[model samples]
Target: MGKPDAEGHGPAEGLPGLPPEWGRVVVPDDASALAVEATQIRRELRRAGSLPGGHQALGLPLVVLLVAVLTTLAGLLAVTWPRANRGADRPTPAPWSPPATLVGRALPALDLVDADDAPVPLRGLLPAMIILLDGCPCPDRVGDALAAAPSGVSVVTVTGGRTPSARPTIERQARALADPAGGLRSFLGQPARPGAATALLVDRAGLVTRVLPELGTSDTYRNDLSVLAG
Candidate 1:
């Protein structure tokens, strides 16, 4: 053993299990205080499940996936729920049925004769308007309709037997046809009446779209003629 130095330090010696460089380290009695505080902080973090390397961190991915799934479910419910609710409250529309009128019925077969008392073939000569000049006054009604008649439509004047006595000029102007058998009147359902001037409107489809019982003006059949022309 050597004598003590002037600072009262003993001779240097190796620790039992420490390395040789440990002798160069400066350790005080308070050094262990910092180490104890660090150990206490680690223990508290473990209890609170906040440790980055503990079991809580290991389950972090599963928690994030669960939150993402919940968010997706919420978005889906928001989009489709309103449409389903609206459809449930909407009313269903009723089916439509055509009215019971001559507008929907086809024209009946006609029996016509020309001026020479010869049978006339009515094939391919439509969309035409038949003017019933049987008891109708002279040529005014037939002439007005013939003048106002649209292009593509043929005007045929039918009489009980003879040419109208009042105005033979305009009466002969139209395609004069005689229906002595009363077949045209019967098919039209027109009764015998004075000044009974009825006009039957026939389309290219041979469908009777209108039946004017007592025609007096040009505008009456003008609108219907335009549509038929189209």
Candidate 2:
């Protein structure tokens, strides 16, 4: 209702959302840009199956979870493949020390008598080798081994500490021993587990050094005694 100002404007002309701040100014290039932008927005909306709305940011986290799950699957596959392909590749260790229960800590002092009533000191001998055997046919597996041992070494055989079942006869090999079981316990420091044989080698200083069982014989005992005697 008011007349135009000197700058060719009215009160409503400069108001936002009604028209341009001054008056309608036409730019053909601006119209073209708007049309192109509208086309791009419509294409994006159609590709997404809906117009962009709430939860649009939730898609990023879903994509991330899928990638993490794929990575975990790959790691599991790698671990399982080697196990599936395992062949007879296990290793067997060489002869070594026996368990602590078999070979005790320090060698303890032992007392024994010969065919005659004489006391012998176990300490300060050049080298002492003890063999435990069940005297039946008294196969004496280690007798020759001990006799032929080095000059300075002493070879003593301890019976499993049992009185022979029958009377002494070369043929009745089972009859010559008494108290064999006890000797095994006192000398070898072993509780004499049945069907088991244990051997001990004490050095010149009487130090409890090497122990050999029927299975896991001491490397040092075999090597040192063999080297000294052999």
Candidate 3:
């Protein structure tokens, strides 16, 4: 009726609308999504190519960093390998020596008496020193420092004595006495000064090498004695 069909060849317009195979093939929703994603990807890739160098600014920096790291590692291994295979050495300093006059010197001849009523000859027994005080503040300071010196070096404390009681007390309290020249007035020449705490630092020899004015420097005295003893 409507144009005979197809002269035994086909059904007019090849079977109305779509073919049977086209009807059977169903396009999924994911296919449309994939086409949209592909179009977006192509556009982005085209935009990226349109840029100045068609390359990312961060790519060159990464490449440079990698190269620098590789170079540093190689150099470190090259130098360190030889050093690890080899060895190192160290040298020490020379020993310290004391003064010339002090070394190998003779002991002094200082005869003294201790609190025990015993006659203690200084220079004969050990390397000794005389801590002479004017009997006031100097004696107090000297007493505190040499309180421990009786066991070590001979501490002959000679103070200017005024009264009979004072002389006995000093003789009894002190480790030793050189020669108690009676009276503080007579010994220190009348009015005594502040620091007549004159300490004669004598070595093994009878000679007085150093005359200390004060007794506050306790460590220095010990160090000197230690050096002398050594």
Candidate 4:
């Protein structure tokens, strides 16, 4: 039994075994409030020299938690920083153009004869420039264009749907061949238009890399052939 407080309640009523003078101290009802009261008591104890300094009170566990957080942040930055820089420095590759009809297909063998009336094997003439023209006598304009063809690419002119004829004038310019049965046109997957020449760029493996349909002019032919050779 203790003395009654100003509120007319005994000091030991709520806080048992505490003096009447300590009645002002509140008794916490929950865990959160208890933690708050404990912290306040520790601060007062430190000021009164009853407890250790604030840094010593927050000992090795607090130091370890701070170090772990800093290390994790540093590790994350080290991993992500190089990726961000590399993405900025990397160059995008050029887009490849879609293949035209007959392009990207393997060139099949065809029965072809040269101006000398000798058999010419299409597969043996790999990586060669096979230009298909519409008529027998190779046109002077087309012959001159074939003459300006880039080096390393053999130019063989095939007359589409026409028999082999003596073209003494153009023979010095290009090796003129004849496709009497229109086999070359069928091999192209389409019919050759009137006076329109189609040039096929064949690789070393006898694969058609490009199909230039209705090639415009001698300059255009020369430029296109140069690029293919390069």
Q: Who wins the lDDT comparison? A: 1
Candidate 4 TM-score, C-alpha based: 0.48
For candidate 2, the C-alpha RMSD (Å) to the true structure equals: 22.7
Better of 1 and 4 by lDDT: 1
TM-scores across all candidates?
Answer: 0.50, 0.38, 0.36, 0.48
Give the TM-score comparing model 3 with the true structure, all chains together. 0.36
| Reference-based lDDT, residue 154, model 3 | 58
User: Which digits, one per residue and each the tens of the lDDT, describe model 3 over residues 1-230?
Assistant: 11222123321222233335433222222223335545755665577678876558445644544444344344334333443323345456554322345424444343445444455566664445556555444556555545535344555566443211123233335444534543312322233346546555555545545545445666667666554444
lDDT by residue (18-136, candidate 2, tens digit) is: 22333442222122334654575456546655546524744564454444434334433433344433566778856443555533344454544443423334343336676555522
- After superposition, the stretches of candidate 4 with alpha carbons farther than 4 Å from their true spots are 1-99, 135-138, 165-172
> Model 2 compared with the native: what TM-score?
0.38
Question: Lowest summed-lDDT stretch of 10 residues in model 3?
Answer: 1-10
lDDT of 4: 0.60
- In terms of lDDT, model 2 sits at 0.45
| Segments in model 3 whose C-alpha atoms lie over 4 Å from true places | 1-122, 135-140, 147-151, 161-174, 181-192
Spell out the clash pairs found in candidate 1: none
lDDT of 1 by residue, 1-230 (tens): 22222344553222133345434322222323346545755565566576556656545644544444343344334333444444787788654322337675676666578767777654345787877877665477777877777788877777886342233454335667877778877767646557667777788888888887777787778888777777
